[model samples]
Target: MAIASMGTTVLDCPDPRTLAAFYAAVLGWETAQDSDDDWVELEGPGGYNLAFQRSEGHRPPQWPGTEHGQQAHLDLDVPGDAREEAERQVLELGATLLQGDDGGRRSFRVYADPAGHPFCLCYPRPQDT
Candidate 1:
């Protein structure tokens, strides 16, 4: 049997509540449980789960050139016509826009959550189907 079973991704933050809320909104998930102030979880769309744990001295990562560095990132796919609106919604939900490129009107934009974890919103590359 394999050791990994696609459980959950845990992120350490100074305040679990804040991080959990941010992710809950971002992922369109709801808080499934709040075991304590130090621990919280959001129920994923399917069977996935995301948890946040409080750390006394948590330091957010810095990305790119590493003035601060990133520990991990998540990518989400959006439809071409709705990409702009989705980006706006994510930013409104507390994600900081990082960068994007012009790939003939369809592209991916990188962003960082409030906890400094990087993520991307992308439009699927044109396929030959």
Candidate 2:
């Protein structure tokens, strides 16, 4: 068996349509052509995509102190020099900055969406490749 490439990333939301719309606005992608009440998909750059399913009574994650630990997180890596600009964009798109230790030790900040999903903005580090 072999994997081709990333098809989609699905998230559970109390309301799939709303969550999908939120992401669509942020990502500047349109809703999937075949979207339904139960699920929605947003296309990503070069056909990468994200899907959301309607989940009843969904509970959002609690981070940092973790009364309920994050089941998963999305790490968004932006160019080191563009991290600040990207952070501004994310905030304008309705994500709340959840944590920041900008004292120079860490080079990333955590943010939460309107639905409380935690995602991180990481400054890319130089790599050999």
Candidate 3:
């Protein structure tokens, strides 16, 4: 028997509502009815729940460095052909590109959210390349 089933994935941020809003917009999710300023939850697709909690002294992780290494990250899969468009959309949505802009020749790109958390937009590798 399983001891416990999976629950929401919680992230600590300076402002829960703001971070939650960012993810909601990026994922096309809706804010949970019980969300508040200190704790906000997004109703993610496929019955998954992503939540954010306020941390007064929150410190964002530093990408590609161990000073404040990324404790966790999200990998959003995008079609190889649509990777460029996805990159543009994320940039417009307050995401800062960290790497993988070599004329879209790479299979994945890294970006930092408004709160400075690192995430990746991944593309499937070509089978016959």
Candidate 4:
């Protein structure tokens, strides 16, 4: 028997609604809850729910190791050839690219959302035939 099921991922940011909106556009998800200014959620397909919480002085994490470390990050995948378009879309949706296909052998690109939470756009790994 299974012990648990999946649940929503909650993030902390300065503005919940603003952060949710940015992810909404990126994931094609819609706002699930917005009763208060401190928290909001976006419901995406496949039972994925992303929530945001308001923090009084939310200092975004600085990736690549600084005094502040990366707490967590989200990973979204795209088809192999769709990487370029995906990169453009994320950029337009307010994601700042941290690292990308700079002619490297890496399979994923790192970015930070509007609230400076690090996330990644990755190409799904190939399946074994």
Best lDDT goes to which candidate? 3
Model 2 ranges off by over 4 Å: 3-6, 125-129
**lDDT (CA) per prediction:** 0.79, 0.80, 0.88, 0.86
- Identify the leading candidate in terms of TM-score: 3
Tens-place lDDT digits, model 3, residues 1-129: 999999998898998887887888888999999998999999977899999999999999999899999999998888877887988888888899998847657678999998899999988767523
Q: Which of the two candidates, 2 or 4, achieves a greater TM-score against the reference? A: 4
Q: State every prediction's TM-score relative to the real structure.
A: 0.83, 0.79, 0.90, 0.88
lDDT of 2 at 30: 86
lDDT: worst 10-residue window of model 4: 120-129
Candidates sorted on TM-score, descending: 3, 4, 1, 2
Kindly give the number of clashing pairs for every candidate. 2, 0, 0, 0
Off by over 4 Å in 3: 101-106
Candidate 3: pairs in clash:
none
Model 3, residue 45: distance off in Å is 2.2
Name the 10 consecutive residues with the lowest summed lDDT in model 2: 120-129
**Model 2 global lDDT (CA atoms, 0 to 1):** 0.80
- Arrange candidates by lDDT, highest first: which order? 3, 4, 2, 1
Q: Could you give candidate 4's per-residue lDDT for residues 1-129 as a string of tens digits?
A: 989987999999999989988988888898975537888988888898999999999999999787777789998888867888999998998999998756646778999999999999988544411
